[model samples]
Target: MNDVESPIDLRNLKDALEWQETANVKRPWRKDFFDYYVDLIRPRSSDQCQILELGSGPGFLTQHLLSQLPNIEYTAFDFSAVMHQLAQEKLHASEKTRATYVVGSFKDAHWQNTLSQKYDFIIIHQALHELRHKRYAIEFHKTIRSLLKPNGCYLVCDHLCAPHAMQNDQLYMNKQEHLQALQQAAFKQIKIPLEIQGLCLFEMNVI
Candidate 1:
């Protein structure tokens, strides 16, 4: 599928909310994905670890992370205003205090400029494909690496395209392609800690 073939228009308030609801029903294992993230980040739970989430649509993962890690500070970065709105509505008032929401698109390399602080953890869940093609993955990963603190972890979870899996080559990368991009971006200690429901979760550290 091409960029125009993207399934949802997150810019619209109605569309964004509807997509959020639909995603809940479609990806029951989403919580499992969130749990894996929690485990990976549990080591930093006691500290005021800074975290940034790229394409943090509607803050589902943000809410889960904040609830699990009370000491962590989170930045929810998304391009769509409606998405941030939905996320703000979903989060508790207490959770909102520790969270900062920013609106920006990763489609542009300059999107990194919007964030001033480096993070202990940088994450993206099922959203990198929104860059519209796998060709952009490496550059995007490089930007993510730059935003990370020394030895920071980048947790990427996204749909995969393989002969036996989702076949949208233009939108999703196969496992090998994903690994190659991370390696080319100079991410070290890369590991595929989880792959479930057609999604792969890659855990890697900044060089």
Candidate 2:
């Protein structure tokens, strides 16, 4: 969290996770993002359900999710080893459920095979738009649907892009395109309460 430089790639994800003191500061608004996100999904998903979080930073919310839900199974994937170590320490310290952490990109070909089971609920908090390219985007959804056990819950919350590109290009998909893409993949979308910073949450039933 010092004045560390961002890694060339997500190799910094672990660093970001390990040194989250800076993350909360860098993105002060994300605290509210997590607050709104947890409030939206925690009550609906029981402990009996299986949940997966893609691009989890340090499992802070992962810890919260486990404690709030009933006998739940948790598997979180992050491409950062630093994050894996930090997450392990935090999760164990909290005495939360033993979480499965896989270290690799979401677009990796071996995901569905390694992940094995479909989730009852999948939450992507603030990490949806980081996915790289168009082909990878298509694969991302295909893999997401594969992880669903029929009508599984897909909760997504991400940035609201400005109408102009070059300036507000952090957003990978426009708000409307994001919705349309989900619908195209057969998700029944319902808009949930939004928080400050244009953070939107969608609860989609994977039918």
The numbered model that scores best in lDDT is 1
lDDT of each: 0.89, 0.66
Residue pairs with clashing backbones, model 2: 14-83, 47-70, 47-71
Instruction: Report the C-alpha lDDT of model 2 over 95-182, residue by residue, as the tens digit.
Output: 4554788787775676667687888878888777656432245457657888888768777776665443312443356667677777
Candidate 2 Cα misplacement greater than 4 A, ranges: 1-8, 12-14, 17-19, 26-47, 93-96, 163-171
* lDDT at 27, model 2: 57
TM-score of each: 0.95, 0.79
User: After TM-score superposition, what is the CA distance of residue 41 in candidate 2 from its true location, in Å?
Assistant: 4.5
Q: After superposition, how far is residue 83 of candidate 1 from its true place, in Å?
A: 0.6
Off by over 4 Å in 1: 1-4
Candidate 2, after superposition: displacement of residue 131 in Å? 1.2
Q: Tell me the number of clashing residue pairs for each predicted model.
A: 0, 3
Candidate 1 lDDT, 92-181, residue by residue in tens: 889999999999999976989999999999999989898988888999998888899988999999998976568888889989899999
